[model samples]
Target: MSSIGGFLAAGLIGAYKYRTRGTMSTSVFLMQLRVAAQGTVVGCLTIGLAYSMAKEYLFDKAPKENAKSLTN
Candidate 1:
């Protein structure tokens, strides 16, 4: 999914460059690489954030009570 999105974004950028300058070349491929790198960084950051949030919300918090009460 991320690869697809990155390629789509890179293609858009390349198309824009072609539209303005009328050419696509190695530089455009390099631009695609840069875009893919950006996508990878964003994906890693998102995963890290979600993991941290889930840990904090679930494992790190105090336990909660159920509906039944325990009495002697």
Candidate 2:
């Protein structure tokens, strides 16, 4: 969640940078929005992948009782 917030902050800063430089027209804002959206999607995917990998590599061999915790 904090990482997502960081990405959002970076996007806002990027937009503000362009706006202050008089380079961010409406089209530029739209493009920035697209970039932010893509960042969010990528972030979510990365989190999912990391969680899966952590479970597989670090916890998959644990006892069945632990596995039940994972499922619920």
Best by lDDT: 2
RMSD of 1: 6.7
lDDT of 2 by residue, 6-67 (tens): 77897788768667756557776778778877987898899999999999889788656633
Q: Candidate 1 versus the native: TM-score?
A: 0.49
| Each prediction's RMSD to truth | 6.7, 5.8
Report lDDT per candidate.
0.75, 0.78
Q: State the lDDT of candidate 1 residue by residue for 1-72, as single tens digits.
A: 976886798678766755666455768757775787688779978998999999989777776656566775
Stretches of candidate 1 exceeding 4 Å from the true structure: 1-24, 63-72
Where model 2 places Cα greater than 4 Å from the true spot, the runs are 1-24, 63-72
The most accurate candidate by TM-score is 2
**Cα lDDT, model 2, residue 72:** 40
